[model samples]
Target: MRAFFWAAWLGLCSTPLLAAPPQGFSFAQKDWELACDNTGACRAAGYGVRRGEVSVLLTRNAGSEQHLTATVTFAQIEHDIPADSTASLLIDDRDFGALDALDESHFRLDSDQTTALLQALTNQRKIEFTLNGQHLPLSSAGSREVLGKMDAFQRRTGTADALLDKGDAGDDAILPATPAPEIIAAPVLHNAQPVPLSMLQRQKLLPILTPLLNQRCDDWQNQAIPAADRQITLTALDKTHSLAQALCWRAPYNDGYALWLVDNAQLSKPRLLTTEASSYADGAIVFLHKERGMADCITGETRVWDGKTFTPSLKYSTGMCREITPGGTWMLPTFVSQVIPRQQKEADNLALRTLYNAVLKAQKSDPELSLNKVAEQFPLTGHITDFTLTYADDTLITTSKPSPDISDDEWQAFLRSSISADSENGKVSFTLIDLDGDGKRDLIIDSYVGGTGLFSYTGVLKRGDDDFAAVNGSDSDNGDDFDAGVPGALFSINGRGANQWNHWVKINGQVYALWYNGQFGEDNLYLLRPFSTTSQTPAVTVRYRYTLNSIRSPEKDQPLTPSLSDGDKADLLRSLEVMQGSLLKDRPASDNDAPICPIPPGTSADEADNYYSGVAVNYIYETVAYIPVWLNGKCYIGTIFSHHGAYRHGVDAEITLSSPREDEEVIGDYLISGLRHVIAITSGWKTREGDNGMQ
Candidate 1:
């Protein structure tokens, strides 16, 4: 049984200084002296003579200011400074021009000197300037004083330096972290008993017992039942009954039970149902009479003795059936039409027998297709485990303690490929599918090859006559005997159709090509060059021209639209064309190294690549393409290729985008917020793991 509840509340405050910070320049510094307002604003002041003794200053303002001002002074010294040697300042990576030079030794910024000057600069608890990749010292007393003040402000308000120094001082800092509460299992009930009572007897004794039951048990919601019902089920027991047992099973439903005897003749009313009593069917069962003059008949299932004197017929039996409607407990075929058919059990048996026979035949025919073979191939060996079969028709058939010979590798692999596997006992199961796409189904055999691997094989039978045979009764191309010279070669005649045969030759470490048809000679054979580098070829190319054009051209000039000129189109096509063949001609063949089998012509490699390459290149490319656009910068793209994981984890090169700035609109769509920290963003929340632990 479960219960539920709810709660609610509200408030306000009064502090003018507690408002959000103003926007603009708020802080700065100079060669030896620094000046700033109480509103968290400052700047840097410096004079350079290498380029006409120009003076530079940095500042920030916080209020509702829209523009920033910079003032500069030039020393009265004639230098080789270029006429176009203009002064500039950067605000959050955005470059802005300084005011025109006042003279050879002085210049003034166009915006406000106080707020704007301070707003443009970032406040560091300790500012360390660098010259030409080398650190510079702020050893002056004024510089030290400014740095001290910034640190004091940061410590007092507990706000970020960037926010406070930018004149946006009043912005609330991040909330303090809190730990999450742990989840515990709900309490369980213990020991319970069932009591029986009759309908007429219960009604006569209800008033006296009702008060006692209410005080002892929690609130009880009565189950739905008709007034004429003879039985009622109690859900929970009182404290007295609960303390008496560890666990007790009540009626499947909530129906109260019947009492064996009632002393109704001695009292004016019958006793009420006890709070310690348990029910079977809630209030589902009710009694009915056979005839108008007959006594009431028992509706619920219970062993009862008939009022007959010591005879075989003195026993009563009852069976359960679905009720036709509310208050209408009639048992008939019309009321329970949705039932299992009589012949279903027999049909199911026949199907299982047929399946069993198929498996037996497969085991007999294939020498390498058994649990023992799987164990021999892989490293798994353990006790016989349980197995189960789930039919497509929603039926779960299970078997326990089957003979164990399947390897652990094969069993684990089988589970990885299929949805069902016993994680605890290391069992492997097979699922049959129509691999050939014929209307008739075929079987897929899967098992644990070893403790660490899984093996699968499609059930296909090869006809002997279909073997490829060499023409002219000679296996050798030259005068050499085929078997004597070509030790690792095999030929077979394709009997399925005309002009169909294949030859397998191990020439090098890689299985080169599987050639078919009579293209080469009368004997159609697959050329398997194991160690020959010439046997392999490049499938695609990455042309520098394509890469450059993709970046230089505008979006309207993309090839996916109305197409392009012959020259442009040819360049794009040439980008994907293979240009060179293997340079190795006399290399020796190695054992077992082979290229992936190629799909038949006319099919695309898209699906195959996607399945084998865990990283989705398209998704990566899209993310990269949008980076610059989001940063409000010119579109720039580059590619990166890296190995991701083992087996089906290789990733190919693709475009990447980069930019600088906090362009909310663009950044929000492409990059996740927490990941921004890694992407060069200065402000971002750390990801938390397992309660309050930062990830």
Candidate 2:
């Protein structure tokens, strides 16, 4: 395989950039495939069984007024066809008419011809073309299924604009064509600076790039390549930034270039963009891979420099190797973007990544490092003033200073407004975003409440009179569960991953937070009215519940089973025994420090075995477990938060009720003052347990 000139196959780039980008869907079956882009434009391509065969492309934009367009191209031939050469369109051996030549190998079908072709494909009739005294057959095998998906994705299946099952149904429900995401590209440098990297500069970058090189470029360790040849080529991206490129690896068809965005000053920090890049030119990292040895089909990608980092601009693929033209048949892109040229000054905004790196760097050595101290150590660029740091255990803003950005009255008001904290007991990180599209930014505080599950909470605080008010319905008198400071409005996700689960979208001019309710059997999409409230407090409604019928039969009432390691069981039972010895009819306040739910003495693991049962909230996956402990010769129900990794947190058994406290009420709040003592002592046990952690 060899590098093919993309400009030579310019005729194939006829796909138009349309206007509301969808999530984009693509499906393939047999010899046919369909692709719908973010703009809702759909393109279906079908071909013969093998490569170097004739193929057809069917395209239709998203809007209701859009019509289907058809084009056909012949297989590779030694002799070039004349520009005036035409191909006769045939449906089941019926010659509809001749198609005008698009170029040497491609032909364009008029609207009537396109309609006839669509009908033949949907009806499973034979489709062929007569060109140069030979018949070029097109398979209609998977055309119906692929085209049907296209119509369904665009919501045109029942509309007049649909290619399949066209009806008189109104086209009002059809998806509109959305514009491709626009990227602001910084001015491209014509040439690199004359000077090569000095020994000192190389030394600084060696540690930072060595790990990446070891992982991506196996050739770096091979003795065949000279040591001098394996160096990175650095080009000035801007005054403070540079682009670093090193050959990552070599493939049969192409060479991979590992690209990194480097900060000229901070050689310790570098971001890896891509390792499969081919070259960097015109402010974009270009990637091209030949699909086969013939170089007839290719896959290409372009990531444009967007001042801060490389942003994906285009992802292109030529439809199957009809071998019609050297660079494949037609342009079929999975992703597309509009690159708007901008001057360096115009694109020189402070990158959020820089701020994130600063924050992470400070916490690298000390995870407990406060964000306020981080800002003090490394002052961030932009017009930000003052800092408020909130910790995991902190109920209020622990440390805050007056801001120059707001007035004395406004600053005080802002300080008075606190985030609606969660009970998951995790540290919070705060950021600002215009969630409501009102131009005024809102505060988003994210926290990872550690347990078995890496459950997180994202609280929104919209700007109020002069401060921020919690969007978790703090002011509501609705007598909901949130009133007791319980965690509410949980981010609709489990585990620590991308912090974008709360997707805020605009519908009919109102911004609503859209999220998926991942219940056991109810996977639903819910829209939250961020500002809508009955009592001036925005509340998230809990519409889904985890009932007995959700996972088990309603008739059976099972006892909690003891699921604990021997060491954990001994420690917890001993703690409970200590509390049992201190129990009194009128328990003294000093006994609050005594551990509760400890197992009674002289009871064997079998005879005095603790029974445990676990339950998880269907939506958030937050789990709770209850265990029956023999305390003071009576069974006391003990409850604890349970999950996959809860054992690592040591034992935190809390007495939820006395023996008669059966049913599901044991999972709820119960009088357990002694449990407070268990919480105080569990930290020491967790620290000492090491590998034999408890729960």
Candidate 3:
């Protein structure tokens, strides 16, 4: 049983001074720091920093319960983050659980997670927690000592209960080694008692049953039913359970007989349902095993019994699912319909068997099977890790598979032309988006031709008479190798590359791009706002232009060629011809298939250079500067000189603006490129209305 974690919000004092609290017992053990008051109340703390900052504390009052609380505080957040953001916790490879924010900087963990945390600390080698995609490790150096102290503190205060103590060695709260569903064994039926009830149960249900075993609980082990339990399963009331409220059945020796009377038993599957008390207790949870494994580790079902029938309430995981991993969780698959059908089971079937049947059915019916007509039927969702879209002719391309007709020589020849390792190729993973802004989902697929680690997408599947169809990519390309080489076409029998939209927005219906790394052709922070009068051209109001390192200040007209190849310089020049457009940010591609590659020791992605080079790494970011754009209007992007003009965008927000400058607006005729766009904005209770403007 998972523990329910309880949380409490601590009032954060300004500039939290993290030192030993002034109290009775205070000690610092490795990473664990603790301070206790005159009473036995103790407070322990530890913290971590990744993309953001957070502090974790485990506290136990003189007579209160133990719980872990985390305080989140960001020093500089400029991104637009929704107030309610959730963070996930992973102890070693197991996902212990998730943390929901109580407020902008306050989050609480359910007290229930304490068991998992303790297990991970004592058994697992690593613990990683992720918030907003940033990962950091949790220190467990002094966790054992700290936990021991907490347990000791409770004992000292006379509030500890051995039976209910979660951290105790005698408690059975941790995940049992012999989990019920997967076992397969048959009970022997040689010498068996018709009904076995101990003195305790006989006293409680004397009128309902007549027991054949007359020995004491400990000695009554001829079969396996404990002769000590007070409550009993009435045979007349339930029969589906193999036990049928009966005795212990054994072979010739009639040894190793133990009662299946424990509320939480140790029996494996075949006898699990029969061993369990047929009488309902809360609800029945069934485990679903994998597609072709002896282990039950895929999905599960929770059903509620209403006397005569069982109704499944929800589906859960029996164990860790590969498809729902650290990376897989981020890249979700798309399904044809949001509403999926659940496989119905026989009314008399056990929950465990019912769940297993559902798993097998899902494997065969899911759209991922990629069957010709099956895709149109019960079309399940496919991988849509990153939201990328492309349009090649009109096809919404996704996955590409090896053609059965292609020979080994042909495949080998094809592999030589690409840069990414053949194993690093992307499947036609797809997602639906409003491609035309009409609010209807359009399909997009991976158009990432191997090489140089740059991932892009190509659109396929044209909408037609009540269906989506692929646009033929092979028709236009002409090739000399009707059998050897092919054209660089995206949809053709040989090639494909579709025009794609990299995250950018058009201002006044005109493409406007931002420099990602720096401003003024230098790395720094700045803000740019765009607004204009109804009749005039849209203008920009650029402000907050500054550098963190004043020594390397940016100059408006400086050339921006840090390093470039002749071909790259040429490609950059041609892209500037119709200069009034967005500058493309060079994003390195991810080897989604790298997990399957047999990587060598000390090998990394940096070794790969071309479309087919260093194919071993997952992802590596390459630093790029802003492009010095030259436009047709000849409006040189230079110094800031506010001209007398009135626009309804800025200046009014700041009453500190000087005379003339208050009403003057810098004409934003020149669309700025090479500037990084803002991804998020920081907001909180303190800065609710941006009261701390420019702070």
Top-TM-score structure, candidate number: 2
State the C-alpha lDDT per candidate: 0.25, 0.54, 0.30
Residue-by-residue lDDT tens digits, candidate 3, 1-695 = 01011111110111111122222454556665555433233455544423234335554433322233332222122343346666667777677677755344444455445445556665636766666766666667776676666555445322332112343343222111110111111122223333454565455443422233343223334434454533334222122322324332322322222222222121121122322121323223232324323221233333433333334432323212222111111101010011111211111123223322333344355412111121122222322224433334324243232444433443343233221111123333343332323333334343444433233323333233343333322211111111111121121111111111222222222221111111221111111111100111111112121111111113455543232345534543453332213211222344223221133345455532111211121122211122221223221112211111111121100001011112223222221222122222221111001101000
Pick by lDDT: which candidate is best?
A: 2
CA error at residue 627 for candidate 1, angstroms: 7.3
How far residue 621's Cα lies from its native spot in candidate 1, in Å, is 8.7
lDDT of 1 at 586: 14
Could you tell me the lDDT of residue 668 within candidate 3?
25
Sorted on TM-score, best first, the list reads 2, 3, 1
lDDT (10s digit) by residue, model 1, range 1-695 = 00000000000000013233222112233333333322233333433313223334433322222122334433222333334335444443343444454223233455443233344333322222222222222222244345445344333233343323333354344221121111111122223333333465355444544454345433322333332343322222322111111011123333333321223353223233233223312111122222211111122221111111101111111101111112211111100001112233233234333323433444456422222221122221222233444423222234322225444433443333323322223443432222222322222222222221112111111111222111111111111111111111222222221223222211221122232332100111123222211111111111111111222122443333223356543543243221111111112333213212232355454533321111224321211111112112232211221111001111112222322212311111111110000101111111211110001
If scored against the real structure, what TM-score would every candidate get?
0.15, 0.46, 0.20
